[model samples]
Target: MKIISWNVNGLRAAVRKGFLDYIESEDPDIIAVQEIKLQSGQIEIPLDDYECYWNYAERKGYSGTAIFTKHTPIRSFIGDFHPAADSEGRVLGLEFENVYLINVYTPNSKRTLERLSERLEWEDAFLHYVQQLNAIKPVIICGDLNVAHQPQDVKNDRSNIGNSGFTDEERSKMTRLLNSGFTDVLRHYYPERDDIFTWWSYMKTVRERNIGWRIDYFLISDSIVDQLEHFQVDDHIYGSDHCPMRMTINLH
Candidate 1:
């Protein structure tokens, strides 16, 4: 199975920029989108073959998440396993026969680190929830996690040391997560590759210069590491400030 995860920034704007065309071209088995920034009944997606599950924030045009899958999951969840703070539409899950795919748009710590404490609390709760599910079945956690877990994951590691996504606290949370039995699919395959990255700033010449961070990720339980076949950063496809990432697995 092939899965694509992207922080589209805004689903409506992405569609205007040929999001549907990209989807048609890639023909992925599943698409997990973050920061949809929409409310219920706001827009109609033309996809008829896929089952679309959305978790919209209480506030319209802000944080949100959704999953479009070609296969019908036996179950789906929003805010059920996640923390109550997930009401912002930050997380959702689809339980297929073999695995549970959790799509999350992790809370950003903001430029000034003002939300860092709250984000850390959310991280602890989210990790607990993920572990609970892992005890049941292997889980594929994929999305824009909003943290650069290591120096290698960030472009300007020296200059961005205390920055929101690269802070010691934030990076430690990710480290604890990996130590808890989840494998970062990309790094597991290419641990020393520093050139690979996912999200880029909108500043002029940033994306063009490839000054980006691999904040987005696909983490799975260690038990299923062999199931992952290939993973790639699709920085070439662009519709938002962040780029899409694709992964192929042998789940079927």
Candidate 2:
């Protein structure tokens, strides 16, 4: 099955900029979208074939997430992580016959690191949540994780070292997640790959020059690593700061 994850920045904006056309062409079996930035019923397009599951932030035009799946899941879970975390509508977990798919938009440590402490706490709780899910079945976790776990994940590693996404604290949390039996599917397939990224700065010539960061990911439990078939960043499709990432896995 083909599963895709994308941080669409804003669902309404993206729709106007060819979002539906792109998804129709890609035709992924399951698509997990982050940073939807809209409350329910604010925007609608004909996506009749897919079952839509959405978590909307209480605050309008802010962080949100959704899953469009062709397959019916056995169960679905909306945010129950914490009051603050749940309020943002950042997580959606769906249980399938064999895997628990979690769509998450992790809190970003702001440029000034103002939310660094809270981001760390979220990381810990998220890992615990994943661990609980994994104890039941293998989990497919995907979304904008909001951190670059390695130097190679971003352009100009030296300059970005202490920045919000590249800081030691954030990177270490990602390391802890990987160490806890989840495989970073992209790195698992292309460890030495370079210049490929999911998110780019909106500044003029930044994305044109490909100065981007690999913040989005599809991580699977280690037990399911062998089932991973292909992982790629679809840099050509554009409607948001982040491009779509696709993974083909043999669920059978």
Question: Which runs in model 2 stand beyond 4 Å of their true positions?
Answer: none
lDDT at 173, model 2: 97
Question: Each model's TM-score?
Answer: 0.97, 0.98
Model 1 lDDT-worst window of ten: 78-87
Q: What total of clashing residue pairs does each candidate reach? A: 0, 0
lDDT of 2 by residue, 1-252 (tens): 899899999988989988899888889999899999998788786889899999999999999999999999998898677665699999998999999999999999999999999999999899898999999999999999999888889988999988999999999999999999999999998899878899999899999999999999999999999998888889999999999999999997
lDDT of 1 at 77: 90
For model 2, what is the error of residue 235's alpha carbon versus the real structure, in angstroms, after optimal superposition? Answer: 0.6
lDDT by residue (1-252, candidate 1, tens digit) is 999999999999999988999999989999999999999888899988899999998888998999999999999898554453467899989999989999999989999999998899888988898999899999999999999988988888999999989999999999999999899999898999888889888899998998999899999999999888889888898899888989999985
Off by over 4 Å in 1: 80-84
**Candidate 1 lDDT:** 0.91
CA-only RMSD, every prediction: 1.2, 0.9
Q: What's model 1's lDDT at 134?
A: 93
